[model samples]
Target: MDRIAILKLNGFLLVTIQVEMHDQLVLRLQDDLTQMLERTRASGVLIDISGLDIVDSFIGRSLAQIAAIARVMNAATVLVGMKPAVAITMVELGMSLAGVRTAVNVDKGMVLLHEAAGLEAR
Candidate 1:
């Protein structure tokens, strides 16, 4: 079962991570989200990580990879709701998260995705 709930909303994939994800769970999420995006043909992906208080290099790298994969599939990726500590940790760990767009919150993320897709915001 997917620990992450991947919901499709307005031609985009909404993923919320509200738990402390183990390594295996995170990997599974990567695979599952990839499949879900392909199956749904979403215009973008918005990952909500406000619930997570920590982010390690492995997790940061995985997030970057997911964004890269989405871009290859012609879908935009917007990471949202990252905590301040998480941001500090990622910077300290030298995780640039290239190719991954970020927003302060889900609303802004949706706006970015909508703009990228050339759709009017709802």
Candidate 2:
């Protein structure tokens, strides 16, 4: 499938973007994530982007939007595993990605997610 998979894990949702997302995929992710959040009532979200080597302005903005929506739905979002080049590109493109917290790896991302959800990370 072209869609990304979002796994529910320990009161949080894990979304690992393993593809170069296009517009439709990004939009669908937002919709699907929203439904998942409501259905699962997750406390936090952890999105891994290590597989992504490039990120355009639209994708960056979409990530921020998804995090915002999650926050509104009572779920915090932590983005993880961003490539250095992708981070630089986003800054150069003037994308702040505000409201979305970030971590260096999935392990750290889970810690942040758990912390935000007021759960003790093991």
lDDT values for all models:
0.92, 0.93
* Cα-based TM-score, every candidate: 0.96, 0.97
Error of 2 at 20 (Å): 0.8
lDDT (Cα, 0-100) at 30 in candidate 1:
94
In model 2, how large is the Cα lDDT of residue 56? 95
> How many Å off is the CA of 26 in candidate 1?
0.9
lDDT of 1 by residue, 1-122 (tens): 64788999889999999997778888998999999988999989999999899888888999999999999998999999999999999999989989888999999999999988999988
Worst 10 residues of 2 by lDDT: 1-10
Give lDDT tens digits, candidate 2, residues 1-122.
47899999888999999888999999999999999999999999999999999999999999999999999999999999999999999999999878889999999999998889888998
Would you give me the overall lDDT of model 2?
0.93
